[model samples]
Every structure is written in C-alpha cells, then in structure tokens.
Target: MSRALFFRLSAPLAALGRSVLGLLAAIGRVTLYAFEALSHVFRPPFYPREFAAALLNVGWLSLPVVGLTALFTGGALALQIYAGGERFSAEAVVPQIVAIGIVRELGPVLVGLMIAARVTSSIAAEIATMRVTEQIDALVTLSTHPMKYLTAPRLLAGLLVVPALVAVGDVIGIYGGFLVSTGSLGFAPGSYIQNTWDFLTRADMISSLAKGAAFGFIATLMGCYHGMNSGRGAQGVGRATKASVEAAAVLILAANFLLTNIFFAA
Candidate 1:
C-alpha cells in the first residue's frame, strides 16, 4: 500500500482506538467507584443526616419539575394519539393507548430526564465545587472516605426515592391525559378514567418503577464520578456539571431500552 494511503487509514484507526480505550478506562473507574460506594453503604460510621439531606435533594425537591413535565407530556401525548387514532377510525383506543404509553415508557423516561437535568447537574456542581475548594482533601485529612461520605448517601437516595417519583409522575401523567381527553376531545370522563385504569397491569407498574431506580442510579453515579474527577477551577466545575447531566441523560435512555427489552420484549 502507498505510504500516504496507509497514513490516512491508520490515522482514523488510531483515533478510534484511542476513543475506545478512553471509554473503557472511564467505565472501569466508574465500576470500581460504584462498588466501593456500595461497600461503604453497609460499613460503620453511617451518616443519617447526609442520607436524609440527599433524600430531600434527590427525591423530594425534584417532584415539582418531574410532575410538571409529566403533566404536560401526558396532555400532549393524548392529543397526538387521539389525532393519530382518529385517522384510522380508532379514536376510541385513545384511553388505552395513553395508559399504556405513559405507564410503559413516557412516565419513567420523562421523570428520568427531568431528574437528570435538575438533580444530576446540581450534584455534579456541588461536588465539583467542593473538590475545587479542597473540601475533598479536608475530608481525607479527617479520615472520612469521600466516596462513603458523599457518594453512598446520594446513590442510596436515588435508588430509593426515584421509584416513588416515577410512580407519582405516572399518576399525574395519567390524570393529565384524562383531563385533555375528556375536556378537549369530548371523551366521557368516567369512561376515559375507567379505560385507563383497567388497561394498566402489574407488569407495567413494576417495569416503570424499575426503570426509575435504574435511571436514578445512573444519574447519581455520573454526577459523582464527574465531580470527583473534575479538574481545578471554575471552568472545570462547569464542564463536570455539563458532562454529568449529558452522561446521565444518555445512560438513562440506553438503560431504558435495555430494561424494556428485559422486562417486556416478549
């Protein structure tokens, strides 16, 4: 092969190799950090206060945004489905379609994205600031493992509370659909409600909450990983925060796809 041709082909190959290596290294680091955090979760010197604060930050405080997103999404989904169904003279299926759509996918995915936007960025920025300010070193000097002190509580809170958020989002989303279909689309309120309720099953509910738990973990872990590894100064903090939310959003979507396959692919 010509030397010039070889250089062109090898340059792109080299870049691809570097990218793959970097990604694998990052994944390995994150995996170890996650395992270490889990180990600390059960060890001595538990911090109830930190855990409680994380619960509030990750779960409770995130409700309004999550709820609003679900509400609006549910309303819009109903209109779209109703219009699409109408084209096929299947408009009566709106209630069932909305119920299935929200419960099986939209509810968890929307809630996850909202939490990623609100919580992931906040967590990343806070921790990155702490790192930049030398608080992580201070924790080490005081014999506190930063992962234990910081990561475990947040991870636990995400795992525990996000499922509840997803559940609430599901309920609120369904209600939003109900309102739109009944009030704007001439759907009988009672019939719409009945169809929605009757169409949902245990599997859908379980799967939705499961996706929430998975998304929560991904969000919190991404935040902590980026924050702990953030470079020095303000720009670093900004980058870490941005990266955390972006990674969380992508991971949540990827996880949702894998989980949906695992739970309902059949």
Candidate 2:
C-alpha cells in the first residue's frame, strides 16, 4: 500500500480506538462514583432532611405523571391487543394479555421513563445550578461532604421509593386496562378481573419492581454525576442537564433489557 493510503486507512481506526477508550474511561468514572456514594450511605453525619426531601421529590411528586402515563399506556395497549387478537380470532384473551403486558413490561418501563424525564431532569438542573453558583463549594467549606449530603440521600431515596412507584403504576395500569376491557370492549367486569388476576404470577411482580429499583438508581446517579461534573457557565449547566437525561434514559432502557433477560429468558 502507498504511504498516504496507509495513513488514511489508519486514521479511522485510530479515531475508533480513541472513542472506545473514552467510553471505557467514562464507565470507570461512573462506577467509582457510584461505589463512593453508596459507601457514604452507611457512614455517619447522615442527612434526614435531605433524604426526606428526596423521597418527596422522587416519589410523591412523581405520582401524577406516572399515573397518567400508565393509564393511557394501559388503555392503548388493550385497544391494540384487542384489535390484533381479532385477526387471530383470539379477542377473548384480551384480559390475560393486557394484564400480563402491563404488569410485566409496560407499567414499570413507562413509569421509569417518566421518572427519568421528570425527576432526572429536575435533579440535574438543580445540582448543576448549585455547582455553577458555588453552593457545592460552600457545603465543602462548611465541613460538609457533598456526596453524603446530596448524593447519598438521593440514591437511598431512589432505591427505596421507585419500587413503590412501580407497584402503584402497575395497579393503575391494570385498572386502566380493566376499564377499557369491561366498559368499552364489552368484557364482563367480573370475568375480566378474574382472568387478569389468574394470569399474573408473583415472579412477574418481583421482576417489575426490580426493574424499577435499577432504573431509579441509574436515573439519580446520572443526574448527580453529570451535575457534579458540569462546567462553569450557563451553557455548561444546560449541557449537563441534557446529558444527564439522555444518559439516564439510555441506561434505563439497557438495564431493563438485561433485567428482563435475567427474569424471563428461557
């Protein structure tokens, strides 16, 4: 090969290598940060006020959006399943299918995504603003640990509360499907409810809640990590906020797939 041709060919390979290295480095940093923050969870000088505020923000304040999303999704899922089942002469299976679909997949996934959009963005922007205004530095100067005060509380709250949100979303979503199946689709209310209840297993509920916890951790961790590492200006804060949401969303989806494989792959 000619020298110039060889140089051109190697350039792309070099760029790809650099990109891979950068990704690995980012993963390492995030993993380390997570370990440190989690370690602080068991340490002294805990912040109850911050932990309570986080629970309120991440769990209580998130219910309305989670409910609306789950309700609409469940209803839509019922309609689609009914319409599709018609082609196969299996419309009678709507109750079982809708129940399984919502509880096993749609409920937790939608709730997690909603949390990522709402809670993740809010956390990222708030912390990024704090970073820009030197509030985090002030905490340091006051003999406070930023991770313990800010990160640990949010992490603990996410781990505890998101599963509960998932449980609520699952119930609301199943109810929405019940409404559509019985009220609009002419399914007998008692029969539909019986079929739904009969079709769900304890393992399905466990898997759904597990996904919720993993997604919650990813959402909050991304927000804290990006916010703490944000640059020093308005533009930087904006970028960090955007990056946090994007990362949380992608990680949540990825984690969902992995968890599903673990829970249901045969």
Candidate 3:
C-alpha cells in the first residue's frame, strides 16, 4: 500500500520535473540562438541582397494585409467607442480614444500577429524545406556560416522593417477612423484629424515603434529557431511552420504586455 502511494506521487512529480527541465532547455537554446545571430550582425561578409530580399518579404509584401486589417479594425473601434461613449455622454472623446488605442496598442499588436501568421510561417517553411533538401548543408560545405548568411539578414530586416510597417499601419488605421467618423458618424473631418493629432504624445509613438521592433524580433526568431530545429520530413516542416506562428504570436503578446507595463506603468 505504501509502495503504491509512493509510485503514484513519484510518477506525477517526475513528469512535472521533466516538463520544467524541457522548458528551461528550450529557453536556453532560444537565448543562445538569438545571441549567436546577433553576434553576426556587425561582422564581416554582410549580404545586402539577402537583407533586401528579406525586407521585401517581411515588410513590403505584407503591407496590403496589414493595412486592410488596421482599416477595418479602426473603423469598427470608432463605431464601438461612439456607441459605448454615448451612454456616458463621452462621445466626443472618440478621436482621442481612437488615436491612443491605435497608436499604442492595436496597431503594433495587430501588425505583429499578422506578421507572425504571414512571415513566420513562410520563414519556417522555406528554411525547413532548405534544411530537408540539404541546402543548408551545402552552405556549410561552401564555408558559409548559415547563421551569418541566412539568419542575420532576415532577423536584421525584421528588426528594421517591422517598425516601418507599424508606422504605416498606424497612419492607415487613423485614416480609417477618420473616414468612418466623417462619412457616417457626423464627425467633422478637420476636427477629428486635429483631435487625433493633438492627443497623441511623442512617447506614445515611440513606444509603438519600440513594440514593433520587439514583436518583429520575436516573430522572425521563432521562425528561424523552429525551422533550424525541425525534424526530418515533410511533416516536420509543417510542424515547424505551425509551431513558429504559434510561438511568435504568443511571444508577441507577452512581450507587448511587458513593454506596455514598462512604458506606461509609471
């Protein structure tokens, strides 16, 4: 009877311990990967063509979807806020609220999630396929450092371009609110624009861009990490792609929360 009880308790404890160890191992590996990739950022053999390609992939190609998502969301937010504020006779604050909301939170988070879904999966799949086909191996055989040639350019592009994407998204989203408010909500175009402009502090804009950079790093890093560690097969590529998106999204959200607190919790 004592042995039975001991086994039951020990089994669960063992599983829990294993889980904790696995999580720690993953964290360590990811940290190491990031450090190694970053170490190559300022090193020799910079690849401008590769960096440009990644910039186009992660930034320019993603503009339409990001703009559309922001446009619709901003329009909806205006409507929702107008309706909700009417109850408290605070409807006139719509411009201020919309500006703050889009710039500080929605724009960065939405853009990040979109990039994770779009860029993260693409990076993971492309890299995983290269890995499976021995392309990465060939790079190594050619005396090329894959981390420097492949990962550095992509990661650096993400770090730079994602902020540009967020800036565009913020403008488009605010424009969306402007359009909806003027057309259907009986708000004056000039007044709405002035209110939005006047209400946003420089700090808000700075934090938004900062969040964009962090989110971009998380998204691309997760993709590269998963792709590099993917198992050997078609199924492995699929799993890596899926896992990259999931991890990127989660990390973006978590990072956003931390950043928000750091930026605003004064």
Candidate 4:
C-alpha cells in the first residue's frame, strides 16, 4: 500500500478502536457502580427518609404521565388493529390482540420510555447540580457514603416501584382499548372483556413486569452514573441530563427485546 493510503486506513482503524475502548470502559464503570450501590442496600445506617422520598418521587409522582401515555397508546393500538384486521374480516380479534399487544409489549416499553424521559433527566440534572455545588462532597465529609445515601435509596425505589407502574400502565392501556372497542367499534362489553381476559397468560404478565424492573434499573443507573462522572459546569449538567435520557431509552428498548426473546421465543 502507498504511504498516504496506509496512513488514511490506519487513522480510521485507530479511531474505531478508540471508540470501542471507550464503550467498554463505560460499561465496566457502570457495572462496578451498580454492584457498589446494591452492596449498600444490605449495609448499616439505612436511610428510611431517603428511601420513602424516592418511592414517592419515582412511583406516585409518575402515575399521571404513565396513565395518560398508556391510555392514548392503547386506544390508538385498538384502532390500528381493527383497521388491519378488516382485510380478513378478523375485526373480532381486536380484544385479544389488544390485550396481548398491550400486556406483552406496549405497556412496559411505553412506561419505561416515559420514566426515562421524566425521571432520568430529573435525576441527572439534580445530581449533576449537587456535584457541581459540592453537595456530594459535603455528604462524604459528614461520615456518610454518597453511594449509600444518594444512590442506594433511588436504586431500590426504582427496582420496587417501576414494576407497579408497569402493572398500572397495563391495566389503563387495556381499559383504553376496551373503551374504544366497545364504545365505537361495536364490541359487546361483556364479550370484549371476556376475550381480553381469556387471551392473557401468566407468562405474559411476568415478562412485562420483568421488563419493567430491568428498565427501571437501567434508567436510574444511567442517571446516577453520568451525573457522578459529569464534567464541571452548567454545560456539564446539561450534557449529563441529555446523555442519561438517551442511554436509558436505548438500554430500555434493548433490554425489552432480550427479555421478550427469553420469555416468548420458541
């Protein structure tokens, strides 16, 4: 190869290698952070107050958004399914399809993405601001572990509360479909309900909740991880917030695919 061609090819290869190394480093750091935070869950000096606050913030305050999103998504899903089913005169399958679609896929994924957008950004911004203002340092000085105090409570809350959110979202989403199906689509209420009930399996529910827990962990962990390692300044906080949301969303979708394959693949 000519000198110029060799240099050009090597430059791109070097850049690719650097990118791969950076990605691996990030993954390693996040894994260690997760383990360290979980370890604190079993240690002394537990903070009930922080844990309670986290539950309230991560679960209760999240309901309105989750409900609204699921509601609209379910309704839209019903309409689309009905339209599509018309081709084969399978419009009667709306109830079963809606139930399975919402429970198995839409409910968990939508709830996770919404939480990532709302909670993840909020957490990253808050923590990044704290780090910028030396609040994390203050916690360290007071004989408190930052990971135990700040990270553990939120992580635990996410693991516990997100599954509940997913359940609620599933119900609301199914109800939305019910409303659309019976009210406008001329589905008899009793038959529609019966069909929906009959179509859902225990495995479907389990997989949905499992996805919720995984997504919740990913969302909170990304926020905490990026916030802790953020650069210094207003720009740093903003960047951290953006990165946390993007990472949480992508990870949630990826996790959902993996969980779905595990749960349903034949």
* Per-prediction TM-score to the true structure, in the order listed: 0.96, 0.98, 0.98, 0.98
**Residue 247 lDDT, candidate 3, scale 0-100:** 91
Q: Which pairs clash (backbone N, Cα, C closer than 3 Å) in model 4? A: none
Question: Which pairs in model 2 have colliding backbones?
Answer: none
What's the C-alpha lDDT at position 241 in model 4? 96
Q: Model 1 lDDT vs. the true structure?
A: 0.92
Better of 1 and 3 by lDDT: 3
Between candidates 1 and 2, the one scoring higher on TM-score is: 2
Give a tens-digit lDDT track for model 1, residues 1-266: 99999989899889999999999998898889888888888887888999999999998999999898989988999999989998989989988988899989999999999989999999999999999999999999999989889998999999999999999999999988888999899999988988888989999999999999999999998998899989989999999999999999999999999999999987
How well does candidate 4 match the true structure in TM-score terms? 0.98
Residues 1-266 of candidate 2: C-alpha lDDT, one tens digit per residue: 99999989899999999999999999999999999999999998999999999999999999999999888888888899999999989999998888889878888889889988998888889999999999999999999999999999999998889999999999999888888888899999899989999989999999999999998999899989999999989998999999999999999988989999999999
**Residue by residue across 76-159, what tens digits does model 4's lDDT show?**
999999999999999999999999999999999999999999889988998999999999999999999988888888888899
Off by over 4 Å in 3: none
Which numbered prediction scores highest in lDDT against the true structure? 3
The local lDDT score (0 to 100) that residue 97 gets in candidate 4 is: 94
lDDT of each: 0.92, 0.92, 0.94, 0.93
Model 1 TM-score on a 0 to 1 scale = 0.96
- Cα lDDT for residue 48, model 1? 92
The CA lDDT at 172 in model 3 is: 90
Candidate 3 displacement at residue 68 in angstroms = 0.4
Ranking by lDDT: 3, 4, 1, 2
